[model samples]
Target: MEKRWLPLYGNNLEAHSTIENRSLTDLLNDTTAKYSDNTAITFYGKTWTYKELQKFSEALAASLNGDQFKKGDRLAIMLPNCPHYLFSLFGTFRAGGVVVQVNPMYVARELEYILNDSEATHIVILSDLYPLFKSVRDKVPTKKAIVVALKPGAEIELEANDCLFESYLKQATAPAPAITIEAENDLAVLQYTGGTTGVSKGVMLTHLNLVSNTEQTYDFMFSGEVSPPPNARIVNVLPLFHIFSLTCCNFVTIRHGGNQILIPRFDMPEVLETIKKEKPFQLGGVPTMYVGFNQVGKYKEFGLDLVESYVSGGSSLPVEALEAFERGTDRKLCEGYGLSEAAPVTHFNPSFQERKAGSVGIPLPNTDAKVVVETDAGWEEVAVGEVGEMIIKGPQVMKGYWRKPEETERTLRDGWLFTGDLAKMDEQGYFYIVDRKKDMILASGYNVYPREIEEVLYQHEGVQEVIVLGIPDPYRGETVKAYITPKPNSTLTSQEIIEFSRKQLAAYKVPKAIEFREELPKSAVGKLLKRKLRDEELAKVEAEQSS
Candidate 1:
């Protein structure tokens, strides 16, 4: 059979080869050399030119030495989307140590787990979280030093507590010794994600992996019209700790010399205010974000009326939400797909084309994707139009899970990374994600994806948020159940939600039972914790049966 190429994916492959020749530092320096006088970052109304960002990063790199930190040591950063966060992270990378990104919203429990698991010797945290650190410091045995950043608009309360973030920067000495790092050999970052079995493991990304992925992302995004729009502004509210923002919003923005207006956290009014002020060209978010943003009462006030592009990822983008956003912004929400292991970008929609709503566009330039179909005998390759595990091989795949060789071996076979995501391809070469393997629900001897049912629920005007999961059932082994959070000021009942879902979903896909909650439990990064909800429902059933 002849090889197939996806539309718009070829142009990026050509550009990526050119980028492969340079090291990450070489790329950073090149961008600074050309756009040094241009603004590279804007946060809290302050702008940093490419030159200033480079100089600050160099100075921060200079402050670390034998007494403070050493080359190849792990340095974790826990902060929001602030200028200091970016400066500290890239500086750590420039200093030759690995950057371990931790979510700023992490509680003591989450912080302790990540700190202990990564065995990070040093950390930079925001001052507002100092008390949480004080609580968990004893639990994190490997952490040797801590630097705090003054939380914007918040008072520093950790002065009496051992180390003040400001005081340490004041005692800065000469630049640290220059260290050599192989673009291919050195570990650049450890971004953590949850597992199907419960434990969370760190996904180890390398410099070459990130650089190559960024280049591919840029090429695909700009492949359509020969020239990208000038002085593009992007609204970045996604946490920088996430792979999506780290590549598309932060690193990619710096590479392109784009102006970024950062929103520390997602607030409808605040986001609207920023949109009104900046009138950005791009909006990057997950499925839930668009759902919330599209429902704002003052949608016309944001001036997104003329926004050019909106990219959705991190979760499945519902066709309903996409349509709603288009009606509000008069623009389509381009959907992409990736995982933390793949430098977080394996596929994205072409910027200048008519997109299929449910598809995740095509494999990025230089990225190869194949369907690994599991059969009764063993796994085998499936042709187009078949659904199975989406195996991808590209420059973006991570080095491996940090310190978990067996798990790494299970995930990365030969050169392809088996993502455990179920998907199928069309004759035209567009890929449509069905659902995750672990998320597939077996009901009445049939397979069902919760996303299909949840999407139906989202179509209901009254349903603000919904999570569909498999609950224990003696008759069927497992049955579909939905937990929903209604829209504000609305009185939506479980029966009503189930009735609404029944109108759209097949009988087997419809929830056998429904539960209502003020809010659903989510990860620090806002991804739904379906496992938690499933466990809660199972516990309730077990207790009821016992009674």
Candidate 2:
């Protein structure tokens, strides 16, 4: 099969097509050496230069090296988008330890499962989240917990064995000890994600995987443009634990010697103020963030015009949201596509080229992508414009899922990572995601994509947010059902919504049932939780049957 995306590469972008054999530590070291005095990160009000970031991370690494931490040990970081999170991340890597990214919003049960599964020996978490760890401390294998205080001089009472983050960093005022790293083989980070199957699994990303991804993303973003334009600034509001932010915000900023304005969480007022004050060149977020900005009414007053690039990921960007955002900001929101398996990025809408409205764009340089139909014998490549499972072969792909050989084998086959996303490639090689394979609804032998239905619902003036799923039906195998939240002051009824959808969608694809709700469930990163909704609907059906 011919690679249609190859000929579409932007000028000078082909140079980065091949994966560079480098480690993330090396990339950081090189960036710090080149941009020593340049501001690397800004949190709240304080800023850390590239030199300072490296020095502090090295110091912390030295301290961890002297402690129970060692090479190959998994060190879990459960902090938010603060300096402590960055310190813990690079420090763990510098100390030859595998950094396990833990979501700060996880409850005790979720934390315990991840900690026990990863077998992490140490954890760096916020002071306020200490109780969540304490509740599950006895059940997990974590040996030490270091608490990072949110404010300066904030006193936190710790258990006998625990230590303060500042006190721990003070252990070494000198440089970190020398360590050898196998970039390609040695795991650098264990990022947990619920892949298509909705089961949380640790994706083992090596130093090379992250390094390659950082380079690929940097190249894809700035192709044909000057590298590290003086004083580049990227707004960082997405959670650092998310792979999208980890690769794009943290690593990509460092790779280009850019300034990162970190926000702990998404507060619309604070985000607007930060944008106005910092005047960042790049803004990265999911679809929901853009929707929020579009609805803020005063978003233009916040100086969004300063943003040169708008990158969206973590889920498909709705066309309605994209159009609204572009209209509001007069800037195109480039929607990329990735999964947790590919170090989280494989394709992005090239900044230097024409961006298709509903497409995830062509594959990144050096990345080979194909849509394949699963056959009885094996996987077969589908024809152009045919919908199938999208698989990618790239250096950015993870080594495998940690301690899950069977699952890893099922996911990664013959050097290709089988992304369980249903997508179609156009004649020009632009990829448009149809929907999740699991989320596709089967009604009367017709394949109905929930996104198609959701897109139509989003066009409704009264619809604020919507999620479409399949519900079990006696007549049909599965019936399309839509859960919707009406806009404020809207008198939207189920019948009206059904009628509107009927006008846009086919009878089988039209939502058979409509359930109005005040709000729908979303993840920490604001991704619609269709799985949760589907599970709720299934439970209801089971309950009704049992009763």
Candidate 3:
């Protein structure tokens, strides 16, 4: 309820009482008009100027409309990071259609649910992934599909209902249809959260929500700079379908009229070489990417000093990685926090001010947060430094979960969003996430947070990566178990990890079980999949009990 971070907010940064309540295309159009000749995108060795990118988007939009895809319709876009992603996104907005972001990694079963649930009538998919969609095509309601092969001539079977992406664009060189947009009410993107805890639901993000978030992210990142320097280049390797990459990388690059250098995937050597060649002023990615940067240990050699700002989101950046990055590059890797429900960014460490290593920093401009715990009576705001669920209220917050009124009601209370994340705020307003509310382990009636144990385990030399979770225990109700990936060439054992953890953690807090693996499960953006590992362990326990 109080603005504890206000006193610390500086660098000429002031909150905007009202951001532009306009469609995302308004942002795209203004940038295109202002910087028509600017190089908008660079994919491999090819580049697209603003004029060319806009013309392509217009052509795609006209063709989609000509093909009977009308306003208010949903068009799924499933592609990796490339120029095609930008075209599909802006084209959907101009065509008055809602964009449904589908992960390129999704299989038939996972893909079918989103296609059916969102009632998407069309999809723009990758040629490589076309057969996967074809496998489940008859089961879904999609009428048309546009398959894109970045490198043409890769054989892909196409029915009469499907067309090649270039062919689809060439069919209509007509101007974009003039479609009126109700920015506040009209849907922009149906961003689906990873179905870790349960079924993934489509988050209804209106044009106003996304545009507002883009503005907020820009202001927070640049410290209220009017515009980035001329010809600024942004090197992005994060997946395009991810909201974090969409807003922070794609949207921000548009706002700045900067050059976006794209990499198809996270090939560490390529990323480093691109940074050196392109001389981008900023770099952003998940914790794992930062870890890879540290592992490669080529910050100075790769000319990382050219990049002045480094951002980490999608998941928490391990403190160890953060420290290692600073030691390697002599620069801070600022970590922030957000969720799909809030256009994915609400707080980031202040770029020009004191940054706490573990905290997710304070709320962004025009946003507010409180750490509140639910009591037997009702929800109550927790005292400073006390652990509780974090609640947020901001213009970036999603309108609601699509078609799921009950879920929408449960997650959005009054004007605040119940994030379902356990956290605490210091007196200075910096927030430290304890863990997910559902991830607390009860060992001998004592609450054990997996993140707390995981952080301690990270200090061990042999442990490369670790995930901790609660397992059913006969006497303790639930015991803590850890799944770990040991460093290459390390002679680490389960007993050694247990003995190491015992020294740093209380006896009850120590992991009762340890399982070693070559690697841990990760999401599309490389966030560790704790729930997936927990589910597998639970399934094994169920089988043991039955036997």
Task: Report every candidate's CA lDDT.
Answer: 0.75, 0.83, 0.84
Find the 10 residues in a row with the least total lDDT in model 3: 440-449
Q: Give lDDT tens digits, candidate 1, residues 1-547.
A: 1235454454434524445644456566778888888777778788888788787777667765634677778888888887777777777877888888887766565688889998887778777776777787788854544455554456565533345545554446687676787888788889987555435689988888888888888877766653335556888998888889989887777678777778788777788888898888788887767777766745677787767777887766667778878887777678998988999888877766658888898778778888778789877878888888998998889899999999899999998899989998877677888767767665533446677677778888988888888876643446798888989998887678777766555466678888888899999999988879877877898899799
Tell me which residue pairs clash in candidate 3: none
Candidate 3 C-alpha lDDT tens digits along 474-504: 4355678999999999999889998987666
Better of 1 and 2 by TM-score: 2
Full-model lDDT, candidate 3: 0.84
Give candidate 3 regions above 4 Å deviation: 194-197, 224-227, 439-547
Candidate 1 regions off by >4 Å?
1-3, 7-17, 21-23, 142-162, 226-231, 297-300, 376-378, 439-547
**How much is the lDDT of residue 234 in candidate 2?**
87
Residue 316 lDDT in candidate 2: 63
> What's the ranking of the predictions by lDDT, best on top?
3, 2, 1
